[model samples]
Target: MKKSLLFLFGLFSLWSFALINFKGVPVFSIVEAQQKTQPLTGKKVKTEKPVTIKRNAVTTVLPVAQYPLPKGSQWSYLDNGSDQGATGWNQLTFDNSAWAAGAAPLGYGDPVATTISYGPSSTNKYITSYFSRDIQIDLNTIGDEVEFGLRRDDGAIVYVNGVEVFRNNMPAGTVNYLTNSASIVDGADEKRYFTTYLPKSVFQNGVNRVSVEIHNRDQTSSDISFDMYIRDKAPDYVCVEDHIACFTSIAPTSQTPVMIIPQEHRFQMLFKQGTAYMDGSGTVPGNHDFTGYIPSVGATSSALGHLSVNHENNPGGVSIVDIALNQDPANPLWVVNNSRKVDFSNTALVKTERNCSGGVTPWGTIITAEEATTSGDSNGDGYQDVGWLVEINPATASVVNYGNGTHEKLWAMGRMNHENIVVSADGVTAYYGEDGGTHCTYKFVANTPNNFSSGTLYVLKMDLALSNDEPSSATATWVQVPNTTQAERNNVTTAAAALGGTNFNGVEDCEISPIDGKIYFASKGKNRVYRFKDNGTTVSEFETFVGGKSYPITTANGVVTENWADGNDNLAFDDHGNLWVVQDGGLNYIWVVRPNHTQSDPKVMIHSSMPAGSEPTGLTFTPDYKYGFFSVQHPSGSNQAQPDATQSNVIFNASAALVFSNKDFLGQQQNLSTNPVVALNSEIQVYPNPTKGLVTLSLNEEADKNLKIEVYDFLGRKVYAKETQTTGINQKETIDLSGFKGEQLVIIQVETGDTKQIYKVLKKDN
Candidate 1:
């Protein structure tokens, strides 16, 4: 059965990527002709757009009451030969292909998803849960008590014969989280069961089936570690494997994020939990200018959560990455100048012209996907032949290149259009999702398992769950990676088969929550996020985002109308147990989802004006939840001939970096001022101060978007011009400054978007 909730998000004009055909009905709210406020007079300011998204819930069979072993009946979990069902607890390190394939009846990828499960037949067997035909252990041989140890991080249920003996009733993490990303990987699921003190007759003289259902939440998050055995009875059993390891028992690893700065100064809290500081001396330029940053140090999310990006659709400014300084909820955030400005030039990775997606690595590095292959040759080349993942150094502002430094080499992973890279907490596994044809989900086990570049990649055959599909809803089953030519993996047919079926509307963004470690990826066109059970064969669907919030708004005295469509681009968990994501719709806004709502919906962390006037694109949390970064691509779309082009700058009005603190919308801005450079007095020249047509401005070639432009008359009446654009280092702008011409002294100011820009333009005597 299909059940969904509600979520709401607005829009942001960013990324020329993912060609969007808004169906002409681009859901947005035009800034009505209202009176203007300070700094923005006469021009329409796109306000918030109220919208609602449906939360689709996947109805699955809940846990049922289990009975005791029956007389002369078959039980589960037998340790005969061939590694039969319910093999109590065994280290699953070698030959995963065999175990994953052998445990077919137990299920693999979620049955309701388009995931691939390996086993005897597509009809049965998935290695997610191992059900057995019971094994008889001599009760007298027992030390007195029986114990089943487990390290399941998500959900694990055990049953004897058809009777449920043990249940890890850990409720699933709430869905529809908008803010407060949890810090640290989801804890491992290690549990133990015991019956040593029970009467020997509890183990009857017959066999039993040790049926177990283990939900992984997500691949990287699945930590199934346990040892089941009869131990000496009494509290002393703690000495046994069951309760052997506590927080102190587990080996903890320490990590530190990389940050390089040419000049040192105070750090600014962009998002929160961490702070990024830079010396404004000669090293930094403007809002988008910085040598490097000091990342907020803290624990990581419970699972793979986020990716950072910068949108550059300039000239109009539909996207503006806002990094609030205040992250604490109880703390009062005081605004300051902690905002760091960035553009495409200083950071070439953000300016990539090819089809690229971002993912985090096990080593706190950025991994970008090279989705463009030889096929889409814009110049009509025979073959571009370029599809691989690129590594980026966030601390050094550097990109990983080939050993020779001449070309950037791809990682061991094969060439394909990757959607997400869900990294594990222990830095051992990386799950990459390739969307296109038959979708392929690949696992990179760094634990020396299998060969390098060749562990095991499975195709999700969502068709296997047809038995559970309801007549009223659409459903599919999952299977293993189809044994086919590697070429098929790159083609569309294989991707479809691999991801269950070709019935997907459009699958995109994939993320794992930090609190629960559940893997979530969406079929953009389908507007759904699927939660794959650890047993790998089960799947569930949830909905909670579309437009604004779940509630509808009535204009003044008008009736209430609901609009849903929260363009979920990507999602990430923060250090403070919050979910952060960027929405792409006509209404641009950044959203922060709370952890546990009734239906698990995302709370609006910060909702800004619509894209018609501003921008807030994709977001990524820093190592520590202290500071986060967001990309503000173009914000307006008045110039693009084809409004649907992925790289069009139609919604770019102006771009600036916004900083927050304590995760508060009104967080205090950190001191961003560095050692001031020699402010040039007569070096810059901007022309046509009061031209009725077009006006052009030029900078020192190295100056950045810090050059702000504004016009004023003798009476101190300010007129609106346009903010310049940034690329590489310098800044420039050409605006139709015609509307404001009845001025005596054409006072032009040029400075950072915050500080007053210096200007001195003499009015021409017509």
Candidate 2:
């Protein structure tokens, strides 16, 4: 049962991380266009894209309900010092004409609301602050009870119409300027609202004034906070978690992102790009110009990890960083420690330019792809320097230069504006996509398993005609290019076209599924994810797995229309076999397709969204499947810093990688306490694990009446599928692998109503 994908509202509780969606902006708009308003620097700006509305297209929008503050509740605040405190300060007649004014939540230590003119520092800060606001209310149209939704630090006392209505975290009898709060408040708890109710009789008919005195727990406290609102009644309540992901500035040097590490009671600056402070110690400063961060762990159990970041500048390169978790005693929170840059110059890597999205091998190395088709050849090796896949060893910080004296370019891969590469689980086969207007999808089969230096490259020539209006598939044949070296042909694009290679529209990232062992690649121009079936030597089946040219477009006037799903790039998969795709094309969305999803049932969900003009890239998941990492790249530069009242406090379009826990997207909270585990049943067995032709499937228990069997090749294409009644109990059946007689791996899946099982079968002979 497949379901069409729709843009889903982020309905998750606010943890340390907050989700932000900056929709309908393009990355290139930053340089060419400008909003007449203040500087954005990397913020959202709405753009009008030409859309042809189809009467039949219906956009599915998930409505989110929020209990927000009513209009005109913002307060004006003044810092109260020991010298200025007076007995009548809480009264409306108090002379406070010289006090400062700002929007509420007037507090320190949070970026979400307007800060009061006071202490983030001990010197310029005051221990207590006084706030007052006058709101006009009609007594005839009001409820009996008034609810004050308040956020404060340490303690606060509220007075309405010169009467003490409520006091929280304050001493019982007497509260003075010098008195401290009864308890200390730290972290996000400071932003929590402590609701206090009072009778409507306490308010006047018109121009009623409310005052609040906020006192810190102590003078030496690191932060102070306060915010509140008055309502006739508590708002229509709903536990809708619309915002769950946190945000950072587009450029990290300006403001580091604050993240709450999963399973830990703390916050940390996970890592920042495009900054001068190189290492976590702040002692060494290397090029802070790194982007497209891909996190890698050393082993299955290690929290300490390494990051391979792509430098997107034209003269760009890749930087490797070593990162570890540290608990800072000052805050008793987890922070990133000793982030050292792994040097790669001494190796054959003299230069790597315009490095963008790449892949991580099963062997634990980073394959950084250069997203260039034409940059004058820099290596003096005849071929251009920018269209190659440069593999780097994270442990040793060495580039696999193939000993050609320069970081060896895999010229045989036939790159034309190469986007990214994905290797099959079998390791001998690799798939890559081209990010060009008329590019072709290609693959390479290594002569030896896991060895890419020597391989036969083939371009896919579809057996069926292609169209942009609809999703299509064909049994494609591989056309092997003769000259495998750049020195021989000098132009891989021409070499690929010389074969019968069919053209695709803007092929982006090619992702090999860990679950189905098939290849899924995104094409921006075509607006579809193409699925392929790869045996060791060639791609046999090619088709659109999900997505098409026309998708439901949301208009500015909130109208549903038909539009293109433009900018589909950077594909990833979680352990659950859900394909998570990010857009580079201007849609600014992160979409997910479930494992059993079909083309008709577009069960794709818009998992994450960003502000307009920012494209999401480098979507990855940790080996433990605990956190998913992605980045918002090259946002609009106008109005990037000002607080958008509608957005989360942490919302910004800074070029930063965001980390979200698996549970945040999966909507299963208990999984947070435990690591995700993939358990295979030992009860089902496939004999001749590395079978040459045929394999026997045996189940320890009785087979259900109707059994479903499926076989997928390395490229994730279904080669064989059957639904049949099996012998009643402990039945055995033989699956013929003779058709797939090659040195490649095939995934066999058996599903019953109650149980499902998967097996990896290696076909080794004729």
Candidate 3:
């Protein structure tokens, strides 16, 4: 999510003149299409071959498929938080409503917030603060061209060899609009470059400090969300065929490298019907049941559905906290009846995060974040409190908490609403999303990094590009905090500062294209998607896609965008050069957006939607690309007493599991559809996909002389690239894939007038 294209009006308010009429799928039926095909007036329908434009211009349009689900093949419904029992449980309740109950030592159950913070984040005594740290990497493996990105609210800064790569410092408050809330390092903001280049030598063998600074104005006080990590591979490092999918049934036969969600570590994902469930159980691949508590309208599979609960953000019946928010056992995970059986009677508990969503670690573990501070007492009543980041190990089936500095600090981070984690290509820096009306995105730079305790944290900020003169969209800059104890860490929390704050739609899930170091994110609050390039600077600018609700849509400028509303959760690119977007199950439907990245005027080539209740969560492509996996966690528990099935669609209405093909989104490969029609012909094509090294093709074959080779994004915007000579036929050419990331697309178009052709290619394992 980026900044709003509108300017500000009042102080606590900014007003956009007109609601720009921005835009907008479906299934099939044999009886439907045939009826239309049947000649109403059989007048020998003259078949028209028309003109033979032998794919004159081959344009490669990456095909999108439904995000895969975890193909656990057989996941036993566990009840315990350990690895042992995987069966039924008698109605059981701990019979306690106290805060941080149980005999466990309260807090995040980790080292107290002494002095050091996660990353190099600074803390403000008055209201804001910062804490910073460093992560040393081997530049040898990570070429000098290493690049990544960060997401923050008001501002941020990333440096390599002390050379600034990213920076931004927006205000506080919050922006709900997607385009207005997201900030990438390139294009949009001068200080933030999307594709920043860091030479291999930039990182010495020993230690390197990755510092961060944040400011907090009076409004909501101060707190920063920052993540720092490093990876040696590019965004496309995981080839389409190699990158595991969103859903399938993988856990049972998961060949995809594993990551653990340590015991006690809070972890949750939308499975079916947008229902939320947590695995409070010890570890993964265990005997003890990981199935813990489920908060919903009710906790039954068929009978009463998991309707709603009155939580902080979710009022009425609609739910918000589907996933757990913390990892400490002291917190009661007791809840239930949302899975296969409809029974809120038995009070089963699970783990959770601190508002910040949990993330899968490179080591195959799940890291749950607790958005609370060390001293707990977010209201500042002076009561002992707790906040920290916890880790859940799948192998060991255990959980550990990494507490925060202060309660207000934890609460300021947005009270257990942590939404995303964008890890670095090498595991040096990690970007975080603070989902809230007055929250900012942040980064965590681990000290020993992989070992934890070392590094700094930085906030996200962007310049107001659309509003030149207005201070709201001022120069793109990323403010820095020497330590987490600084005086101002909420600098970017302003509606204007953080490009409209976290309003219309706040940043939910963020991902980067390893190939070009481009960043993409979903703004659930806004129902939009955005892009950011890496050019070396604080991230602020973002390209966008206004994918309409459940429909294939294109921008007036010709570029295609993805769409969603409260369309929360994950994002990823497949080996086929396609971008897959996942929405919250409860959002009413499933949508897949396919944009012709190679087209000059790219349009959404495909769009598909499914019925309600199919709550989709987590996504992964199998290593073989033959299968995919995602988690459709069934709903559980109800605020009221237990309700039987006759009541309503209850929890099951929010539960589901899905698995579709690579072309599922386009309805091309899939046979079933709510409205499947011979969709309009797309202006895209590609070749030698899953190639070992080079790939080539042309936009139009009519050109007798030359073809221009370039790479574009979903919005049809070209990024840093070069041209090459094609063979006599439409300028045949080859590009070195050694420098590129994962399976990506390269466009070759004819220079001869308006002639064009498109081709799709894949760069993969040799």
Q: What lDDT would each prediction earn against the true structure?
A: 0.35, 0.57, 0.33
Candidate 1: where are CA atoms >4 Å away? 1-352, 374-384, 401-412, 432-455, 463-503, 536-563, 598-609, 613-615, 637-652, 655-657, 663-766
User: Which candidate gets the maximum TM-score versus the true structure?
Assistant: 2
Error of 1 at 700 (Å): 61
RMSD list, candidates in order = 29.1, 26.3, 29.1
Best by lDDT: 2
Q: Write the per-residue lDDT of candidate 2 for residues 624-698, one digit (tens) a residue.
A: 554455666655444244321112244334455445542333222233223221122655678898888889987
**CA shift of 426, model 3, Å:** 0.7
Q: How accurate is candidate 3 locally (lDDT)?
A: 0.33
Weakest 10 consecutive residues, lDDT, candidate 2? 50-59
Candidate 1 TM-score over all chains jointly: 0.39
Sort by TM-score, top down from the best: 2, 1, 3
lDDT of 1 by residue, 620-668 (tens): 5444334444444333434222121112222233333333223222223
Q: After superposing candidate 3, which stretches have Cα over 4 Å from the reference? A: 1-356, 369-388, 400-416, 465-475, 481-505, 534-537, 546-568, 585-587, 595-602, 605-614, 633-766
**TM-score of candidate 2 to 2 decimals:** 0.48
lDDT of 3 by residue, 207-323 (tens): 554433332222232332332233332333111211223222111111111111111112222233333344332111100101111222322221111222111111101121122
